[model samples]
Every structure is written in C-alpha cells, then in structure tokens.
Target: MYTPGWQIVFLDDPPRLKPAARLPRRPFQYQRWEKNIFSRGKTHTPVRRTVNICPMHTLSTISSRKSTQPFVHALAWFVYASVIYSANYLANPAIKLGDTVLFLVPYILTFYVSLHLLQVFSRLGTIWTIGGVALFMVASTTAGHAYLFVILPKFGVYVFNPAHPEQFAKDALLGFLLYFSYALLYFFADRNIRRRIAVTDLRHQGLKRELENAKLRELALRTKQENMLQEQAFLRAEINPNFLHNTLNILHAQAQRYSEELATNIGKLSKMMRYSIQTTEEQPGRVTVTRELENLQLLLDIHGLHCKDPKLVLMYIDGKPDGLMVPPLSMITMVENAMKYGDLTDPENPVLISLIMRTNELHFRCRNKVMRRTEIASSTQRGLANLKRRLDISFKDRYTLCNRKDGHFYNVEMIIYN
Candidate 1:
C-alpha cells in the first residue's frame, strides 16, 4: 500500500531489523520509521499510520508544569536572604554566623507570608489591601524586634538593657520606620508597573480599532467604485439601441436619394459607435479635443445633408486643439440640441456653434433661434441634463456650463479648464 509521503513498517515478532532502531515499547505505542524501506531491499510498499493526540491531554500536561513555579520562587528568596545575612555575619565577629542565620529564619517567613497575604487582599480593593499591608508590616516588625532583643539575649548572642527606656523606644521606632518604608516602596513600585501595563494595553486596543476602521472605509470605497462602474456600463448599453435607431432612420432617408452618401455616412456612424463604446468603458470617459471636433463635424455634415438649407447651420473652430482632452460627445451634445430645435430656415438668425481655445482653457458657445412660439416638449432638455451630470462626475469643479434665452435666441455656453 502507498502512503502520501512517508511509510511505516510493523513487525509481528520482535526481530532485530538491520537498520531499524527500537523505540521504547509500550502497550499501544508504535515506532515511527522515517527512512524508506526500498533502501533495505523490501519488496512491498509499507503503509503509514498516524496516532492523533488529544488537545485537552496536551493542555493538562502544560498546566501541570505551572504548579512548581511557587516552590522555585520560595527557594530563590531563601537563597537571597541567606547570602545577604551571611555577608553581615562575616562583617561582625561578635555575632555567630549560625545565630545570624537563625535570626533571619522568622523574618523571612513573616515577610513571605505577609507578601502572599497582601497579594490576596489586593484583588478586593486598594483601601483594604493598603490597611492589611500596613498592619502586617507593623506586626512583623514588632515580632522581629522582640526576637532580636529579648530572645537573642537568652541565647547569649547579644546583650539588651531594659533599664534605658528611651533607647529601647528609639530602637523600636527606627525598626518600625525601616520595615514600613520598605513595604510601602515595594507596594507603590508594583502599582506603578501595573498602571503602565494597563495604559499600554489601552493604547494597543485603540490602534487596533483605528486599523479596523481604516480597512472598513477602504472596502466601502471599493464597493462604491464598483457600483458606479456597473451603472455606467448599464447606461452605455442603453445608448447603443437609441443611437442605432436614429442612425438607421438617417441611413434610410439617405438611401432613398444618395446611395453613395449613405455608404460614407454608415462608415462615419460605425466609427462614432466604436468611439462611444470605447470611451464609456474607459475610467474617465475622455477623448482628445481633436477627436471630439472631428466627430462633431461628422454630426453637422449628417444634419446638413438632411436639412433644406445647409447654409443656416454654421460651425467655427478657433486656435489649435493641442494638449487638450475632453469627455467624448460633450461638445456635440449641445450642437445636436441646437440643430434639433433651432429655426434653421431663417438665414439671418441661424444656429451658430463656436469652439475657441485660449491657453489652457477651452470655451464652447451655441446659439439657436427657437422655431416654436411655446417651449418645445422634447427629450432635448433631458439629454442636456444627463450631459451636465456627466460633466459634474468627470470634471468636478474644473468646468462651467450655462444656458440662457436672450430674446428669440436660446444660448448655451461652456468653459473647460485643462
């Protein structure tokens, strides 16, 4: 049998294989074989078996190791106390080293027990812990002093004078102050360390929240962008059907009279369609000013061929179109609106379209005499509104569009800053 990566072999009888090392034998334990059996002239492929250990069992084993830590700390404290007092004994020849060691025994025991008690009480509250620690320091200090002065004299290690009450009082006060000061210092230092750790933890949590918020904002922006692109694509898909309808109508009209002109117009329409589709798919939906102007001229030519008096529809271009780009079909949209609703029959007040470029700015102006006495109820206004929206989305505040009616002439003007 073939295994994924490794193989294991088991023997029924305990026979010493040439290159196999024996593992410690247990009732259910199996030996892990790492080397391939082919190297040892084995004919059959071996199957590997995996023994799964429970996570709870591993966790219990790790927890068992923590029980010895308190004993280790106690041993370390005992060693530290022994070294310090032994040095003191060596310095003073009057006190025997054994007596000094015996002297430290009660003090160490009282100190550790008080420390443990304080640790337990600290979880209750600050006030209670402080009171407990103060009381412990006082009791331990008094007990240690009594042992040193009263009990040590009995052992003939040191002498004490009960006659001088002032000296005894002074020594007791000094011992109390020393023990109290040490305890308070340790307590304050530990509190300071814990406070610093708490502050660091709060700071880390605040940074983590800020990072999460930043990621959420980025995700929202990406989703918004995706939605906008999807809407643009939907709008683009809608345009082709309407555009083909108008182009087909124009082609049908031209085919009745000039078949040669119909072929040329069809090619122009095809180019325009390709450009429109390509520009809509682009991120900014932009094209060069030269390309926009060429398409606009094509639109004018188509409109002029259909109109009775072609001279009434006029277009003028001023300055070079170098280093200039614009949203596709933007300029042509205004011209189309003018041509659709303008009084083109009147040669005196004809539809006028002008594109002027000055430095880094491009200005476009369209003026057309309204043919109808009342407002023209057509899709012209809706198309203009859609164009305005596209301008706002693409150019932001970099362009301006204005439309006003002066007497009989409806004028639309736009300026785009490159």
Candidate 2:
C-alpha cells in the first residue's frame, strides 16, 4: 500500500485480535513476492481488432465462379467418357478386351502431354491452348486410327482384324479431345482467381490506411484534453493577490510625483489587466509586442518614481514591433524583479531594460546590480516562479528563461517565439 516516496507509521502497538476465518491470509514473504510481480518491466502491446465486412461476400463470389466453369468441365468430361465407352461396348459386337486397351493408349498420352506442356511454357499461352484444341480434334477424328497402325501389330490387335486398328485409334482420340476441353476451362478459371486475389489485396491496403488515420485523430484528442487540465490548474493557482499588491504600491508612488505619467501608466495597466485575467482561463495567450512594451513601460515608470535615484533607462535596438503577438505578462516579471532587488537606490546604480524583436522572436533582457543570495532567500522569487510555470504550460519548449549574476551585475534574459 506504500511506494518509495511514502511512509507508514504507527503511534503505539495495538491489542491482540482474533484472525478472520473467511479472508485468506499470507505470510510476510507475500509482500516481497508482490513487489517483484508489480516491479516487472512493461511488455504490453496494442491489439487492434478489425471486422472484415466483405470476406463472406468475397468467399461466396469465389465459390460461385468455381462452380460454373471448372466444376462443369470436370463433370462433363467424366460423363462424356463414360457414355462413349458404354456406347462402344454396346455397338462394337466384335470388339475384344485387347481392342479396347489399344483404343485408350493415344487418348491417355495426349491428355498427359498437354497438361504438362501448358504448365511449362507460359509465353506460349495462346499456342498451348490452340494445340490442346487441335489435339482434341485429332482425338475426335476417326482418321486417327492410322496412328495406331504403327503399334497395332505389336499388340496383335491389327493382325486380329483389319478394322481393329482404326476403331481402337478413334476411341483414344476421343478421350484426348475431352481432356483438352478440361485444360481450357482450368486456364480461364485460374485467371479469374488471380483477379479476385488482386482485388482483395487492394481492399486490405485501404483498410490499413483508414485505421492509421483513426489512431492519429484519437491521439490528438487525448493531447488536447491533457493541455486543458494543465490550464485549469494554472488558473486555480493564480487567484492569490500578491502580484496586484505590488502593482498598487508602485502606482501610489507614481501618483504623487507624475500625475500625467501616472494616468498613462494606469491606462496601460488596465489594458494589460484585460489580457492577463483572460489568459489564466484561456492559453495559448496572445498580446501584441507593442502592447507588451507599453505595459512594461508603465511598470518601469512606477519603479523610476519610487527609487531614490529616480532614473531607469529603456531602449530598443534594431526594429520596432508591428502587430506581432506574444505570450501575456512574459516581460513584466523581469522588470518588476529589477526594480525590487536591483540596487536602484544607489546614486551610481541604475536598471536597464532592452526589448528586441528579430527573426519572429521576442527578446527581453534586464540588467541590474546583483542582490545577495540571502536577500533573495528571505523575499522569495514568487513572481519569477509563477511566470516560469505559466510559460512552461503554454509555450512548453518554445520559451527559455535564464538568470545570471556576474561579479557586479545581475542579468535576466528571456526568449519567446511569436
């Protein structure tokens, strides 16, 4: 029930109590055993369950095609061969067992050779098909009995009767003719199967692309929800009144010395308020660079009035701003720190604020005499800490803040993208 960062403590030993019967109990070794189980490295892989909408339909299509051409060819060939053999038995009264054996020899040779040749020579697809047909015709012809004459005497069929050789040859030729038809049917059926397979492959590719796009959209939505939760936490923490108190004290000092300047500063402060209050709710925030500097100048004016030296320098190098937007309150935090901790009351010491916009980025640099570490520890860097958190939540890796102290001076630098 406890992790490395948590602790369990008991004030005093408790009284003895009877153990329950229904609940299971384990020895102290169970705790160590549980730790090992939970401490194992993750090996979870995402499983995607997909429903194939057209598989049943595709299967039925393949079955339909197979039944029509190839199945019919097989059935027709068997039936045709049986009918011919039966008719010859009934009509050829003089035909013997030797005559029938001789008749089947040519048909068997032609069917086996045609099937083998078609498989070996793909470029001769048309020729093979035509040759199969020609073999069928020769087998169908009664004249093919002449081919059997060469082997008939050896078999003793031709010597038995003069018509023996011719009649046996016709029967063999008929068998070859039927087998050729079966081969043609097989070739066309194979082409159709290939086409079906290509269509299935294309459909699978489209489904994969769709699944990938759906996953990307889900990830984007989850990221958006995480950002919203972070923004809500920031707004809840922003309700403390410390920052507003500092602004009021500075404004009070400015009101006594520069009435006209005080009014201008207050106006700019009001405009800044409109942006800052809303940004606690909605960020990524937006403020034009010109507006950001105007707000910075207001704080600087108040600081100038309150300090004993009553002088601070504001300068902009390179170009001025033109409608470029930046994150709200990014520059004012540094300027306030410069006024609070910098040695501004010393006649020789002054604070400098520089605003530069280059390459679609805003640069804020503040320099002052370094305040001691003990002084910073006492007062705490609340404003700088709050600003850093806001920047991290809104801009993430797009912003940077650094504070450096050399021997005599303190420097704060910030870079934020437009």
Q: Which runs in model 1 stand beyond 4 Å of their true positions?
A: 1-258, 376-378
Q: What C-alpha lDDT, on a 0 to 100 scale, does residue 118 get in candidate 2?
A: 59
What Cα-based lDDT does every candidate model obtain? 0.69, 0.60
Candidate 1 C-alpha lDDT tens digits along 1-418: 4434422211212224343544333212223334355555655545444432223433344355357757975797678667866787688756565676666565556545655665556444567767887787677657766876778778776534667757756765564555445545655564454444434444565598899999999999999999999999898787875578577657756675767677677766666766666676788767889989888888887787767886698888899988787788898888988888888789888888888997878999999998868574457778778888888887889999988888888999989988
Q: Write the per-residue lDDT of candidate 2 for residues 83-151, one digit (tens) a residue.
A: 666777798767675566466555545655665555444333456556755664654444445655556
Task: Name the top TM-score candidate.
Answer: 1
- The alpha-carbon deviation from the true structure for residue 122 of candidate 2, after best TM-score superposition, in angstroms, is 17
Model 2's number of clashes is: 2
